[model samples]
Target: MQLSETGRGVLVSGASRGLGRAVARAFAANGDRVAVHYGTRADEARATLASLEGSGHVLVGGDLADPGDAARVVDEAAEALGEAGGGSGIDVLVNNAAVNLPHPLAETPYEEWAALWQRHVSVNLLATANLSHLVARRLIDRGAAGRIVNIGSRGAFRGEPDHPAYGATKAAVHALGQSLAVSLGPHGIGVASVAPGFFATERVASRLTGAEGDAIRAQSPFGRVADPAEIAAAVLWLASPAAEWASGTILDLNGASYLRS
Candidate 1:
């Protein structure tokens, strides 16, 4: 009943659908065991686990907005993936869980704007920070090497007029990853982040239709948005041993839609 003892244990947060699910699949296909974490979508998370290419994948449920719940989620993942004499069990931590809701300045009330900002900060920035700390601390104690790949957004560099909170928090995530990369590199733990533009995810299916979709596709010269698999592939590579040297890097997956000097 113990999962594959040969592969590394991977924990991917917010993996109920879209990019998170794609990332989980990529890791599973690479022969690693994945812990799929979901906040409010147990059924979707289960489906994600079922659709994986291999066995030994587990589902973890938690509302990461709460610090206590976040800690518990990390502990559960480590315990589930731990081997008889294995280290912390989880060798890779993917901080992919986030909330992106719109609150346009002029159109929203002050109270509503404040509440949305708080929610965004809790779910997107703080959860990621806490999870990274938990995983990195364990890896350091065990004297093992690991990787942390944060799912950031191109909105961080560009702009999210309608979703300012999302953009700001994602920028914080990217900064956090870079700082961790510098500090964790000495411990053989590489940390990196990927900032992606609009992608084909269920959450954005509505925006990718008809005239709106056409405008979005036109953002990139390629005349199309990215497939979730494309971003997942980059995440997979970043977690690989070969990518250690590329630590502290924030690879852009926006397909030239937004460029920064």
Candidate 2:
């Protein structure tokens, strides 16, 4: 049975774990069909798909590092949802997958740095752009508007002491979201961003310095890191009807940790 005559499709990159899984689950909970994409970890991806709250979800497997593979992933995702029983086109597109390269400037190699840039830019920037274009075309053809949510990081602006490449790339993501908001708004599509502070993900939990991490914790007015669900909550709102008027805005989900206060 078709989820809908136009099965509201959502393509979530990196849906296997962490913040991506949280975002995927949120979309599923709201009855929007989702395509779970994962690279290298098919088992984990399958587990996530199995745990989703809604039905009509499909698992898409591929590595985003390859240009051909990247293009295929989005096409497959959009197609999977359509096969589930819809043709109205993708209603929501969440660009939640990004690479975080944290090596210091001098310590990293020239080629290493270049590769990091290429990987991050290709996955974080180019692939996302391609998907946006495809979805926008589909949405415009169907004469229906949609939503795109780009997950960003505080490191985008904070200019952290290390990870120069990651900082700069995320900064680009911020710009991309804004530009899409402007270009797509007139076409009936909405683009927004979720700039999350240090969430209590395994990545952050493993990096916490005994004293330094504690200090970062104290820095937050809440004295703790944000839960992934909190970030997911912001995403759910942005994709829902309540957030239609909230285009081009980056909802800060950090616990005031990096606030200027």
Best by lDDT: 1
Q: Highest TM-score: give the candidate number.
A: 1
Mark the regions of model 1 whose C-alpha exceeds 4 Å error after superposition.
1-6, 83-88
Per-model TM-score versus the true fold: 0.96, 0.91
Query: Which consecutive 10 residues in model 1 have the weakest lDDT in total?
Result: 1-10
Residue 139 lDDT in candidate 1: 84
Query: Would you give me the overall lDDT of model 2?
Result: 0.78
Candidate 1 residue pairs in backbone clash: none
lDDT string, candidate 1, 1-261, tens digits = 122223778999999999999999999999898999999999999999999987778899999999999999988888888743564478999999999999999999999999999999999999999999998898888778899999999999998999999999999999999999999888989999999998999989999999999999999999999999999999999998878888999999998999998
Against the reference, the lDDT scores of all candidates come to 0.92, 0.78
How far does residue 88 in candidate 1 sit from its true spot (Å)?
5.1
The true-versus-predicted C-alpha distance at residue 219 of model 1, in Å, is 0.3
Error of 1 at 226 (Å): 0.3
Indicate the TM-score of model 2. Answer: 0.91
